[model samples]
Target: MNLSLFDQFMSPTMMGIPLILLAMSIPLLLFPTPTNRWLNNRLTTLQTWFLSVFTKQLMLPLNIKGHKWALSLASLMVFLITMNLLGLLPYTFTPTTQLSMNLGLAVPFWLATVLIGLRNQPTAALGHLLPEGTPTLLIPILIIIETISLFIRPLALGVRLTANLTAGHLLIQLISTAVFVLLPLMPVTAIFTAMVLFLLTLLEIAVAMIQAYVFILLLSLYLQENT
Candidate 1:
């Protein structure tokens, strides 16, 4: 029996130990640790430069208060980027592709930001429920709508990451299957399709990295509002 295309998305297990945990650990292996020497090797230097640049750009929007989250936010960025890039590799699992795991990552941080806003700035946080100068007739309705939207933020965050990755993976698989089926019977069509598959792979590489960045950037925005 042939396995379903989505079987690839399932968490692979060995003796009941999920490999997702191991997949998550792989990105850290890519980074080179700094040495005491004054001059670092080319790879280390490049890694340092890339991370510093990302941190600088990411932090530029926030005030001094939000800078406190530099470490957490930066670490989240690395974690996400690593997971996404790793998922693109053969026989690798993308943990973020799972809705539960995505929500697990999203809800806590999203709630923390909301709580920070509520605890530190009650009036401002509450004020977000309804804008100033609203007509008396619409006040209750507006508040209800805003409240629903507020609670949906975490759900949106989780679903967005999962859906994008899942769709990209599915499309890649469908095209690949077609390429194999058509190779002998329709050589010209298969060749054209193969080109498209190659281009899509490149695009998927970009999507993986970008979806990771988008996730962290949105979280930073939420934190910025709270701080």
Candidate 2:
């Protein structure tokens, strides 16, 4: 069987990032000024809470750079999230579900934090990576563990987003097909299928918001800690 166009687009890593970039860049290009400070404020609050959670209940940065960075990041995050949710519609592809696409979006921020730490405070960066407050004998173990965990953040972020979208889409497809198959035998099954599709559509909306929040929260936490 020939693969559909949807499958081809969904398979590409480069497919999703451009859409997200376009979604993000449009507003910035159209409205250069901060016409709506409400969004900015909301994003800042999210960043604060997110950082606090990851930093063992420690305070997070509310500095200019932090807010500015979050503002920029939030725009991208919103776009990616919208695109992901939109894909749940009939005949649409979820781009973030691709490893290449999510990694492209995630790695830049991950590397940016690294650069920020290295440029501003090399010692802190080293400490952040190697860590301290461990027994001498456990230092090596801690280093290996922390290093693996640190590197895995971006991979985990990408995989989680991709996997969630993939699973959701697959469920929708499977449920629809199952309903279609059983519809010939039972009309009530068709009705139930329709209900499921409706419910799943709503759930997809929540999934979009949740995926966006998770991605942004993790990114903010990473930046807050590294910087």
Candidate 3:
């Protein structure tokens, strides 16, 4: 019934309707909803604590102007981490694994940062393209290189998230298939393989969290230069 291992990454469809929206919505539901009360319960307390810590650490380096982005950046971080960790579950889709989706998320925010820099400090932004003490021979080359790197930021963000998630999913699938095939003929080997798979799964979970952190951290860094 299966065609290729990569098929796991394909968007699921039924009756010609893609379920990507449905998939993307699932993680939102998993998040705990807060209540308006003076005294919060344990779960809400824990969630609040975690978010406070994360946001504080994330925004510590930014200035007052950049502090305006705290809420947006925090929400983005939560959404990304949830999507990633949820995708690691069996039979769940990873929206972040799609390069199109990742790019959609990347480009707008990145462009916004650039536009902010252009609006607030155009001279500094343009100045970044040319160094103060550049040789005549290398000016053209340096400008071209800087231009290319500036344009590459969004592409890099999208590709980094996609490749990391895709690779982890593929590896887990491959090892799982190998374990299933070997179980009957080689029980000992299969058991060892399963142990390895267990460890890898743990590693993948960390990677899921780390990639989300790194993605937003890079965005914050970009925002830093502009703000």
- Per-model TM-score versus the true fold: 0.95, 0.73, 0.96
How well does candidate 2 match the true structure in TM-score terms? 0.73
Cα lDDT for residue 127, model 2? Answer: 88
Q: lDDT by residue for model 1 over 113-133, one digit each (tens)?
A: 999999988899999999999
lDDT per residue for candidate 3 within 12-87, as digits (tens), equals 8989999999988887787778878888888878878988999899889988888888898888888999999989
Evaluated against the true structure, the overall lDDT of model 1 is 0.89
Error of 2 at 48 (Å): 20
Error of 1 at 191 (Å): 0.7
Off by over 4 Å in 1: 1-3
Pitting candidate 2 against candidate 3, the one with the higher lDDT is 3
Write down the RMSD of candidate 2 (Cα, Å). Answer: 6.4
Clashes by residue pair, model 1? none
lDDT scores for all predictions? 0.89, 0.70, 0.92
Best-first order by TM-score: 3, 1, 2
